[model samples]
Target: MNQPTHPAGGDVQPQDPPAAYPPYQPPAMPPRPCGIKTWQIVSITIAGAVVAIVVIIIGVIALSGSMNRVAKEAKDYYDSKAEPYTNPAERKTYTNDTISFGYPSSLQEMSLEGWNYTVRKGTVSDRRVFGDKDMNYFVVYTQIKDDGHPAGMSKLQMKSEMSSLFDQAQSSGSGLTDVLRHEQLICQKHESNDFSDLTASTGEIADGTPVVSFHYVCDSRVENEDSKIETYQSTWYDHKGRLNTITVSANAKAKNKYGRDSINIPGLTARLR
Candidate 1:
């Protein structure tokens, strides 16, 4: 039988239903290898950092302790080498017409030969010398007439006098050379005789005395010997209208048994009239 046609249109064939799609599924992933978890990794990193910090702290503590020990050992070594001040009672008194002072009994009376002096005199009146057995170190205490120099001279005057004296020594072929140090020293009485407590002068000394100090090196003058002699001197005018000088001479090759640059000026002045 012939099919009926629609008006002004050709017959349309039936379309198949839309093909069905499989349910959406993602590609399968490979299995993971057995390993530490994220939290475990974090814990291990923190533990390593803590251990490093602990090691640093221990190293610092050990270094600090070593430094402290070294410092203490240095101090102890110097302390042992230092000579203590002689007790007043145990000290021996040296008395002369012009001056009287206390000296360590360990020192014996010495001669004035080869001693260097800043204030030269035709003859040292009322002089006393004391020194060690080897004479490597000695102290000369001498007094001279004021020669018109005023007592308690100013620092300028003292310096001028020192220059003049050094000039004289140089002129006289005394072999003094190389003025290593020259200055005014302000000294005060201390409860102990330790000279390490000496302080620099702040223009004036409160209840203290001022003295001029000098240091120079001289030829040993020994036959065929190339050694030098080191000399330290201190000069001050006392109220007695006299010039007092204390000289310390040391052999360049010998150690400083007194462990001081100069004698205790303040202590000696206290005992001087």
Candidate 2:
């Protein structure tokens, strides 16, 4: 159908000329995929978890094994160190005849578990004990006993007589009983029949008296070792040229996990010289 045309400048203006046709254009779209999908992300997370678990488990096992090794090594070291002290056969060289040093007839010849005795002059006899825990020895002057009666007597009989005499001497006017009790703390609970036979030195005390010292362990209840130490000094001397040893043993276990030697020795010069 034909339609009337209107002037371009008309007030109502003719309907806008038909819109000029434009070239066809495609709709906007996102870039093609270059990243992980949801499933891929989940798979990566699962793989990381498995690797982490394996590493943790391996680390724990390694640490446990290391601790066990350290414990075993420590046990072995202590066992080896305790071996020498436990063996009774290990003997220390010593003079059997204490008389050579001008000790009194009351002194005796005896052998201990860890000592070697070489008698020079006086005859030695061994004393019997209720158990092997105690070391009891008696040394008697055979030259003074006269008339063959004393000489003919058996060692056991001589020891018995000498022991009686010693008991009497200890209990007699001499203050041996008080000395023993006073020195009890030095020995803890153990007592020795002979103090002269022990090793002696000049310790820290100002007194020039000879100092005797030894090492011992408490009954198993305290520790399974000979870890205690003791020291004694000459308290009194008799007109008869006798020395009464007053002694004490000190303990370091209160401060130490194991124990320390009773004597704080600086060097062999002090001990040997």
Candidate 3:
């Protein structure tokens, strides 16, 4: 028993120094994939929805504004034609020692808004309208107003000079649109005396013969405005020693219904004193 100790080396020998712990290696982990997270995707979706809603609301407001503008335009057009003519006091007969014209107070005022209407420019020296609130219709009467004749110029000289001026007006290219571009033919060789008061002019009855200008002038609806063009058989013109013209005004739809003779312009001309 005393010798049992003899087998073990008097004291325990130290184990090899712990092997330096291998520099603390951590477990390898795989890299995360490169992309948006679920929360990020949800945020983007919400943002897109907000933008779409805003766009839709803006579109609706714009459409409403456009509709309102169209309505106002129609109302103004209608009022311009209807209101003034409504009151008996608003309309009056035109009379002069040499000529008298205008609708009788007894007759109801007419307008395209109410029904198709006709206004005969039927005067040698005047212009009028049935429903053209824009005053698109006009009559131009010219008589050698100083015909380029000098105080002492001979009759032949005066006539020659005047002729030159007249030609200038006929072919004036400075500010005139080529009428052929806007003119749409409706009638030709129309009867005269039907829409002219020229027969009563002081000089040559201006009505060289009975003929009316062709029907249908294509023009804008508003005064001094150049949009929304429509054509109607509401215009007439002739030279009876004087230039007579009757301009008709109506919307496109109305023109289809009313026609060029809605006002009996010819009858009006013949009726005027």
Candidate 4:
């Protein structure tokens, strides 16, 4: 190669600077989608939830069967250990006799001097014998026994008996003649349903005898005011299957000739439980 001559002042012009080279750069690739990883996570979460639900349902079905078995076993155990109230034959006889005549063997003797209570056999020929030609009325008394000792008589029974009396009152004319004839019609129909939803309860009687004295509502609706009346009732019972006291009363609005008067039981409070 021939050497080039330099100018007297300096070396030959510097060789042209090497042509400028472009900066080094890495190759570019297309960007990935935004949520590919997110979609994968969601799909896995949904699959896990479905599996968990199936497991829980299976567990509940199994548990239900076990619960049913437990309930049946408990019922069977209780039934097996239960005791009877009384012998079947004796019970049937007692129920029949008591319901028929208000006579319970548990009560040795019962008497209500002013109650106008009576028992008569055969059907009542005349309706409205008890002053309820339009409405049904009856009165019944049943003795409840707790150990040869009487617990208390049911006031419900008195309501039933009175209903019977009302029916008897319908047919016969009032006065001494009708009063004498009242004893024979105990269960005559003109059926009445009297209930005493206990409004107030008085404490037990002094005799340590169980007594349920309460105020009740009497639902008596007869056509004629003179014939039959209905309103509030207060009843008392002793432990001897005898009704110790009874008062049929009414509010100011129930203005019937027969108003508030305590029934005359003479000395019934003496017989407490």
Candidate 5:
């Protein structure tokens, strides 16, 4: 090493600091595209959540209405299929000159010990008074002992008598439900049914005899504007010249709305033997 004289006679000329060393750096990695930003992804998720909530609410409302309609339909179906108003446990047997059958004990014997409401020749010998919890009731009259028409009444007259007797008391209402409510009816032709036989004169045939029956409906609106309906049905039959009569009544509104029909036609006829 050759010793060199400093310029200006001092170390000021020591020289520029050593060239700056290059800055250190880590090794590079593979380049990648930026994915969705955090903020954008969060916003998208929140919007989706809101949309899902809205859909759930709409679905709930629709489901609720459908459930209500289904429930109502089920109730109406069951009501239509239910049994009649008569109590089945209390059965009573009765003997009549022309026929015999059982009836619900809930019916009260109408004629008393002294009062004999007798229509000669099965006109109206024995009767039972029956009503429902609503005080709606019916009367069953049968001929016993005195078989055949009244002494002087002809067969045609007797048949007419049986046919028209119970009908006179029937009243009019919405759909003709009330018995005492009097309204013109849309009468149907007498037809054979499970409960009664068909005949030329009327609806009833008793022990092969041509009896009489009339089934008609009254206009429910004729009675009360708000009343739904009033139902009235009657049947008459004869045995050995004796008569068997049955009357049934119902309130249509009460029955459909509250399932409270008090009439039981099948029960009354079941007693016929």
Candidate 6:
């Protein structure tokens, strides 16, 4: 080893050369297992969504089938219950000068004077011929003389007139309030029919004379108490040019027993001469 001389010194100690070093390298990481690919994850998600959709569709189909079955069963039950009403042996004929019809023998003929609303000034005759055992249901037959009112009025005309009467009665403090719903309906005289199958429709009878129907619901003071009444009125002109009106009234409690849907308007009208 040679000694190096300093600028101001005679001899300097021998110096070691710069140390050599290896290139820099990062630390090694542990080996890892393969992870799921993005495509595989997406595919799995799509497959799950498809399965869910299929399940929902199947459930919907099953529910629809169940609902249909329940509806059919209900219809069959109602039809079976109404069989007696359709049988003539279970009913009695009620004939008067204005109209005639068959009513269930379970009901009895009642006095018209008890029905306060049926006593109109223009009415020629009024008869509350049939009522349920509890007096909750009433069928009134009425004839209106063509004094100033037009004969053979249309369904719309009848609806308007009846609505006016309702408004008047309410305004006059007749205890008729809250006219909830009112609508014109069709009246058909079927040759042979099932009461359960009869529903309120809007059209004219093809073979027989057309009849107008109106359905209304209101709150009235009956027997010194407030009550909800549902009334269905069917009107037509007789051969003598008088307006014949058949009114069916059902109180709230009686609705369950004699619902508007259960009344066979066509059957009753068919019995009218």
Per-residue lDDT of model 3, residues 225-263, tens digit only = 333333322111222223233333334443333343432
Question: What TM-score, over all chains together, does every model reach?
Answer: 0.39, 0.32, 0.28, 0.23, 0.33, 0.42
Full-model lDDT, candidate 6 = 0.52
State which candidate has the highest lDDT.
6
Superposition TM-score, candidate 2 onto the true structure: 0.32
- Please tell me which model should have the higher lDDT, number 2 or number 5: 5
RMSD of every candidate to native, in Å, equals: 18.5, 16.1, 14.9, 18.7, 14.2, 18.0
Which lDDT value does model 2 have at 68? 97
What would the per-residue lDDT of candidate 5 be over residues 135-204, giving only the tens digit for each residue?
Answer: 2233344344365344444456656755565344332213222222112221121121211211213444
Give the poorly placed runs of model 1, Cα more than 4 Å off. 1-104, 111-123, 150-207, 221-226, 256-266, 271-273
lDDT for each residue of candidate 4 in 87-110, tens digit (9 for 90 to 100): 211211112221211111111222
Clashing pairs in 2: 108-138, 108-139, 186-248, 186-249, 217-226, 232-247
Q: For candidate 5, give the lDDT of residue 151.
A: 44
lDDT of 1 by residue, 1-273 (tens): 999676576667776888699778999998988988999999999999999999999999999999999999999998676544453235577665434556556567866665454434333445667765545555567677746776555556654665565554444332322222111111111111212212221121222334555544454333222244555566555544466666555564334544453334324423323
Candidate 6 lDDT at 171 equals 48
Question: What lDDT score goes with residue 198 in model 6?
Answer: 20
Clashing pairs in 6: none
Candidate 1 accuracy as lDDT: 0.51
Ranking by TM-score: 6, 1, 5, 2, 3, 4
Q: What lDDT would candidate 2 get against the real structure?
A: 0.34
